[model samples]
Target chain A: LAKTTQPISMDSYEGQEVNITCSHNNIATNDYITWYQQFPSQGPRFIIQGYKTKVTNEVASLFIPADRKSSTLSLPRVSLSDTAVYYCLVVTNNQGGKLIFGQGTELSVKP
Target chain B: DTAVSQTPKYLVTQMGNDKSIKCEQNLGHDTMYWYKQDSKKFLKIMFSYNNKELIINETVPNRFSPKSPDKAHLNLHINSLELGDSAVYFCASSQGTVVTTIYFGEGSWLTVV
Candidate 1:
């Protein structure tokens, strides 16, 4: 399993783009970068998953560099509802769904 | 329709008592899991089952045993619960061993007094 590092918290205002980066230096070849959003008292929701390059979805976008050592999650035009803890995980496909979560970046979206 | 659902969203019990949390997934997924989130907000995997067979068992306590009667159902039973066992337990599921994405259910808040 690959260990990941990310910021502890971030502050952003509404309508501003926010980017949270995660570093996985020992990422394996089969590892995939996955981002999840978690609200208070709720389950974490999957935002996006990427292998390399860039991947975008309706909720967020994930950018992985060519080296695959780090990745970024971009939330466009944030809102107060987007204030939540975002987890970046290095998911191994063959690990029987063991997603080791790191200390997620707590994003507080201001008014 | 809800994909993954767990019962007793909140559980309050005394120490040394046994309790169970039931979970069912309507997504027809083959793999199911149980994760524990401590008060410090660290999420850790406890168990994983595929087609009702045990696959991954972390260093969880022996008192914490997981039962999966079928592919869609996974239940967690804790014996002699302790105060330190208090945390949010999440039930999740995926379609295969190769995890593309795992869906989580609203956690079951367990408080052991």
Candidate 2:
């Protein structure tokens, strides 16, 4: 299991782009970076995932450098509904999908 | 239509009581997991089961027991619950043992009074 580090909190205005970076210096060869969005009183939802370079989805985008030591989650055109805690997880494929979540980045989208 | 679901959305029980949270996934997933989120909203993995076999068990207490009758169902039973046990328990599942995306249920909020 690889440990991940991310910002504790971030503030963004509506219609702006928000990027949250996560650092996993000890990322293993089989590790993949995944981002999840959690809203109050709801379960965490999958946003995006990436192994290297950039991966884009309907909701968000994930960028990973060649070193695989760090990754960034980018949310475009934020809205108030985007205010939630985002978790970045570095997981090994053979771990049977066991995810260790850290103190996620609390993103507050203002009006 | 509700890929992953858990029973007893809210449970308020007295200390030392026993309770169980039932979960089922209709996604045809082979792996299921149990996670606990504290008040501070930090999620921790408690257990993982793949194909009805236990694959990962974190340092959770003996009071917390998990059972998976089949690949689609996993239940968590807690005995002699303490005040510190007050947290939200979430049941999740993934397609297989690989790093496929994991889906989570709404969560069972347990309050030990």
**Over the stretch B58-107, how does candidate 2's per-residue lDDT look in tens digits?**
99999999999999999999999999999999999998888658999999
lDDT of 2 by residue, A3-89 (tens): 999999999999999999999999999888989999998889988888999999899989999999999999999999999999999
> Which 10-residue span in candidate 2 chain A carries the lowest summed lDDT?
A91-100
- TM-scores, one per candidate: 0.98, 0.96
Per model, kept true contacts as a fraction are: 0.81, 0.83
lDDT digits (tens) for residues B40-99 of candidate 1: 899999999999999999989999999999999999999999999999999999998888
Candidate 1 structure, TM-score to reference = 0.98
**CA lDDT of each candidate?**
0.96, 0.94
Model 2 iRMSD vs. native: 1.1
Candidate 2: misplaced stretches above 4 Å? none
